[model samples]
Target chain A: MHIDLHPAGTAAALAVLGTEISETIGARVSALNHAVCAAHLVGVIETVPAFASLLVRYDPLLTDYDALCAQLRRLASGLNDEAAAQGRTVEIPVCYGGPYGEDLPFVASHAGLSEEEVIRLHSERPYRIYMLGFLPGFPYLGGLNERLFTPRLQAPRTRSPGGAVGSGGQQAGSCPRESPGGWQLIGRTPLRLFDPDRPLPYAAGDFIRFVPISEREFCALEAKKEGARP
Target chain B: MKILVPGPLTTVQDMGRRAHAAKGYPECGACDKYALALGNLLCGNEEGQAALEMTLSGATVAFEKPALFVLSGAQANATLDDRPVPMHEPVRACAGSTLQIGPFAEGLRGYLCVRGGIAVPPVLGNRSTDLKCHIGGLQGRALRSGDVLPIGPEPSGTTAESLRHAAGILREKPWLLRPRTAHAYLENQVIPLLRAVPGPQQDAFTEEGMRAFFSGLYGVTPDSNRMGIKLSGPSVQTIDGSDILSDGIVEGSVQISANGQPILMLADHQTTGGYAKIATVITPDLSAAAQLRPGQTAAFRAIDVREGVRLCRETAQQLRYIKELTIHA
Candidate 1:
């Protein structure tokens, strides 16, 4: 793996893998990120990996840019693409249409297809997780079918609750918490993407496949989730 | 300490959850970390000890145990059992005493640091509250009325009796151990000149746009919060637009929106952003950035990255000096 270092701020640096936004680059970035964290170098704090770059924050007082770059470069050389390319694919049970998915009718009408067709196309294939950002546990997924492409809401909703499965532009993901958003909601997930009591279910480089479920199944899963919580 | 009145917004914060940023967690901590450190040092606690960060309005509390505490950051009109308690100096509180802290007279946030720190269960290896994700510190929420805050055990050497003695001696002279740098001059009334260094996306903005950012005066909008400081100023012209592929964002990043205005990312800002960044406020000036209130005006002055790092070292030295002065001779 090869990487280029750029100054992010006074105390942080951005390690760029490549300018291209692809699953290959995301895998390479994730591999290097994991390696850097595992090394536990002094002065290094944490790292956030995006589509094609990883931001590494550190303390300048303990280590300067030159010393830190040498350490990162050394770690990058030891990373293999195979280690990060393969990640566990998690199945998310989603309930499509009706009140759970407020904009499903609109999306189906805009795409010149029936509501069932839209759901079938969306759940037909698994999407690659490029990164998790914007909000906590909010996965940025890639490879959305062009047939389902739709613009965001003209005016964003004031509050959208967690477990909201939505799509915007070319990306699709779930809202991990109640927040103001402009995504077009097409479904709702039964599982919590982010829970304070549980570890984050997904991360960058992982794949998520949506499995369509009936509204009754959604309710049953929701009840089980609540019952499991303390 | 037991909270009698929870005030407007109060949360426990330390140095923040720095390790969880990679996992989509914002590094939520005290907006003004320098002030938090000062309060901790004054109370003879570790610099990163968890303290109650009260914003705008302050909380009214009753001490269930005798402890030495210090109030830092914004200046507040506080009374302990109806007796005035001075800022920047250690004040011993007896058990059952009521401490009423009024709205801040200056600055935006104030920190209350007890010797042992606020003993809240740590979430994700941090006590700082992340309100958006609902995790960490006091059940992942702000302190409310009737909340009972437990204090951790005091460290060696800073016993209740020793603290009582130190408070008495320090109150006599006051000036000897008082760290003037600990005080944020947020009430100066004049527009603060914030120092910044060019960000990675500096080339995305035109020369004229860069000039507008450095020369123009920006007003702090009311929409500003811990997430980011929204600024209203002259439109900064971009090469195409301010939109870019979403990238990692750090505190102090000056991201120009598609509307041409700038938003300074703060402690609770998102881990990644898509707006084009023109510059980043230096680490030393972040305290000043955190103190800027709504309706106030601020200007930016460009500096090199070397100078920015140098200022950070200088701030660290100043904190060490204060630490040495506060230690009993």
Candidate 2:
């Protein structure tokens, strides 16, 4: 995999590890993210991994652009074939259609498929976590069924409930918190995508496989979590 | 201490909630880091300690016990028990004394730092209030009327003793003797000449778009906030369209929207953005961008990355100088 380094700002650089959004490139992005982070070059503040690029923010006081760039190039060259592979798979239980999935019918209508077919298509494969962005703990995944491709709403939804599973433009994402959005919602996951107490579960390169569940089961799990909370 | 009348917007902030950006959280903190640090320095508190980030308006704070605090940034009309207290100096307030910070005479944001600092529980290694997720500082929200904030224990060693006599009155030091004078100067011109480096997508802009970005003076729009400073003026167009693959966004990224109006991302910018960012404001000048008021015009000039880094180093030296000026140091 080839990585192109570009100046993002005065103190940061954008490393384009791959050109397109695909599972192979996504995995490579993860590997580079792992390698660069593991190298821990002086002055590197944080490395943010997105779809196919990593934004590395650094401190100018510790190192300048040329020195850091050379160090990053050297580090990138030595990355082992065996990446710091972390593919911890998470099984998210989701309730499809009805009140929980506000735009299920619309999605089905857009795809010219029955609601069940849409649900089956959505849950059939494991989606790769491309990045975490747009909202806290929100996962930008790439593994939507080609037929499931849909456009964003003409007018954005002012508020999307937390845990709403949505898709738009061949990308599927689950809302980690209640926020305004434009993606068409298909389902809601009972599981919390984010919690301050827990470490961010899905990093770039992790896998997310959704499990379809009934509305009743979703409520049951929600109530169980609420009951467990002190 | 009770807040007699909470300002329209006042929240506790420190450096920022970094590291958490990977989780899509914006590192919301003081918009003006230099001013905040200077205020903390004057109060003999660590720069990272929590301080109040006051908006256009200021709140009336009632001290339960005697405390030492300093104000920085905006030149606000302040009074201590009906008497005016000096800004940028340590002042001691007796129990039940009320500190009122009112409308600003200049600048938009202000910072009020206490001796030990605001003792709100820190979430994720910061006292910054992330209003989006309701995390960090005073229950993850802005200060409200009647809200009481606990003050921490006074720090052990600092310049608090040296400046004690000047308490209740303005600082006695000359303008040159005081620290960080040039860093906190108010703007006078209607247009700010912002220095920037080429963005990752700088090549994506058409020749005309590039020309407009540097040639035109854009006015800050009313729709701007901590998220970003939206500007309205000559629109820049991309030869490859405005869309780009989603990637991480920086605080000073000048993102060109579909409409082509530039939006200067700031303190509370999203972790990642999809629009094509034509340029990025340099680190040293981000403070200037933060103070830009709506309807104010701004222009940009291209500078090499090395020049921007030089400015950043100078800024760091200023911070170091302030630390050394402390009596404890």
Maximum-lDDT candidate = 1
In model 2, the Cα lDDT at residue B167 comes to: 31
Reference-based TM-score, model 2: 0.92
TM-score (all chains, Cα) for each model? 0.89, 0.92
Best candidate (score: TM-score): 2
Candidate 1 stretches greater than 4 Å from native: A1-4, A18-20, A73-84, A225-230, B159-191, B324-328
Query: Candidate 2 lDDT, tens digit per residue, B1-329?
Result: 67888887898888888777777889889888877887887788887788998888788999999999988877788999999987787888999999999988777788899999998988888889988788888999988998999999988667566545333222433331222212212365545678888778888899889999988878888888888999998989799788888899988898999998999988889999899898888876777777777776778887788878887888777666666566533
| Candidate 2 Cα misplacement greater than 4 A, ranges | A79-86, A226-230, B163-191
Give the whole-model CA lDDT for all candidates, comma-separated.
Answer: 0.83, 0.82
Q: Clash pairs of candidate 2? A: none
Put down candidate 1 lDDT per residue, A1-230, tens digits, no spaces: 78887666688878888877777887898788778878898999888888888888988788766788888988887876555746668788889988889999999999999999999999999888878788877888887888999999999999877788889977888787778999899998878667655787777777889999999988888889342211
Q: Write the per-residue lDDT of candidate 1 for residues B1-329, one digit (tens) a residue.
A: 89999888899899888877767888899988888987887788888899999988788999998988999888889999999998877788899999999999988889999988998988877899887778888988999888898899877644444444555555575543322222213555566778887876887899999999998889999999988999999999999998777878999999999999999988899999888889988777787788878998888888777777777887777677556555643
